[model samples]
Target: MEYASNASDGTQIAYTVVGSGPPLLMVHGSFLTHTIWRTFGYVKALRGSRQLILIDSRGHGRSDKPHTPDAYAMTNIVGDLTAVLDAVGVSAVDYLGYSFGARAGLALTAATPDRVRSLAVGGGSHGAQAGAFDRLFFPGCADVLEQSGMEGFLEAWSSHRMFPIDSGTRAVFSANDAQAMAAYIRASDADSGLPDEVLQHFTQPSLFYVGSEDRIRLGDTRTAAALVPDSELHIIRGFDHATTMAASEEVLAHLERFWDN
Candidate 1:
């Protein structure tokens, strides 16, 4: 079922809960919604062992789309997750996040360690994201969004992909509000990433994974794992950022062992 949680700023975040075990909060990357977890078979693979809490980040999926940059600040993004947790009555949860969501996980765990039991990151990095955005998406992505919106941004993004995005995924991408996305990207790029001191002090068991071919993030992901006192690193051998999550079975097999131990 779908539920709404009001963020501190009054934005209504949409979320869904399923399965019957301990709660596992799942967060998606930019331009994607919680449903990707289902589309990519993560929900099916994990629901038997985990009660899934899937959330749609602000400006994506069924959540309120705000067009101002301040509305998408790291504080507000973190607030949205906490607001949902409060509404759900979950004191702490195991978190699994990808790309944009992975970065948010880092911020959330750093700021509120007691609220997360464990963290799993896919295709994540530990540095300011502006350069990665430029390299992975398109140079001056925010400018492209402002000038031509999602259509123009996707047009440029197509060239960077190893394969064409499926039609269903394309439809989801097209539905997003361009201005809200632009604000999100600008806010994300402006923020400095978590300091090493924070990662060094983190107490949760953490798992950091990046596709071997996702070279832009491999080094940062490795650094994050090395810094965390209780952490493990995994490299999905031949996948790239675009194909990493699609290798759902391989990803989940590793996660099962990580969460089990």
Candidate 2:
């Protein structure tokens, strides 16, 4: 059920596989472990008909922690996922990447031809608009961790207009390593260096799902969906970035629709 993939930078990426059938990779967003999918009932629903490969991205869960942001670059992040697939003997996989995970997946598929058969992305818009909040989102998160530690950071983060942490989610978030997460946040602020050609050249079955109420990422998501060669854009009714997980059933339906094709 558990496996370790050797990252290009020598970091060990830990992952777990649940159920069995067709292989499907599940990548969690930043500040979250692979457990997020399970917490939101994604694994429970999809695993019934497909294998769920849940990854603990470096610096997140059981994966080895790297001190620098270079280690967390989008390329290396994609490498981590490929390494997991290689370890599991899967040549290609359908993917479901959330937020940061979705960015990584997009870059991975773009960079490595035929690596991903299909992709279903949620809550990841590559932050074209998030730049406006960079001051509050990127450095602010790190500052909170430095000045107030996990409790303080979470207190402030849970209050942020963007991050709405519910009671159950908060309980699971208690496992976060504040310092490491802060480092990642700072590092991720850098340009991912993923050329626009990646998306322009993407030729695959893809779905860009975003919440209707998500102010920052909706337009970007719409743009991406329009650009991809074969893609569909779906807006979750009354959902926002933070609350998208609450709409898991609807999200899964969209993913399944993509997968069935």
Candidate 3:
């Protein structure tokens, strides 16, 4: 069942808790909902061994969809997460965030290291707002979403991106609110980012993973692993940006070892 966590701004963040063991929080990337983890089998894989908390970030999934830009600032996103944990009465948890979710996770870890046991950032960067990209991604995505709708946006996204999005991820992607997602894309880089300078302060054990073929994140994840204290990097060969999600089984092996220790 899904539960509501009230953000400081009165936005209701929806999340679901499943399984039972050490608490674990999973945050999905932009343009996708918390259901991605469950649909991809990550939840079931860990359900027996951990209490998985899957959250729908603002403007995504069942969470309150606020069109205002200020509602999705970095601070608000992180606060929404902590509110979920507080609502569920989970003090600290092993956290895993993907893509956009990872950026928020980094900020969350920097702000409250005590609340995060270990962080696993997959296909994500330590500093995405300032990262090197040959082209503007989100701005273009926002335009496509606004003008073309979800189908058009996905077609454009898949055509330009490195990997083919799997059926499962696509199904989850199709269910997203178009207007909210467009707003999400525009608000993505508006916040004060979690820069490389902040990594030295992250003393927790962290694991960063990316596909070897995912040129967009490969360098950032590597640079991040070096900058984040006590962090390691794992690259899955033959995988690209979207397949990195499809290759969750292999990636989860690395994450399991990281959290198990």
Best by lDDT: 1
Compose the digit string of candidate 2's lDDT tens values, residues 1-261: 466666467778888888899999999877678888888898889888998899998888888877676776777787888899998889999888887788878878877768888888887765432233354344467667757777887687667646476776676666777777766776676744455556778877889998999875677788778778878899999997767877999988888877888
Each prediction's TM-score versus the true structure: 0.94, 0.90, 0.88
The list of candidate 1 runs beyond 4 A from truth reads 159-166
Give the CA lDDT, 0 to 100, for residue 125 in model 1. 72
How many steric clashes does model 1 contain? 0
The local distance difference test score of each candidate is 0.87, 0.78, 0.80
Clashing pairs in 1: none
Candidate 3 off by > 4 Å: 128-139, 155-171
State which candidate has the highest TM-score: 1
TM-score of 3: 0.88
Model 1 lDDT tens row, 41-69: 99998899888999999999899999988
**Positional deviation of residue 96's Cα in model 2 after best superposition, in angstroms:** 0.5
Order of all candidates by TM-score, from best down to worst? 1, 2, 3
- Tell me each candidate's RMSD, in Å, in order: 1.7, 2.5, 2.7
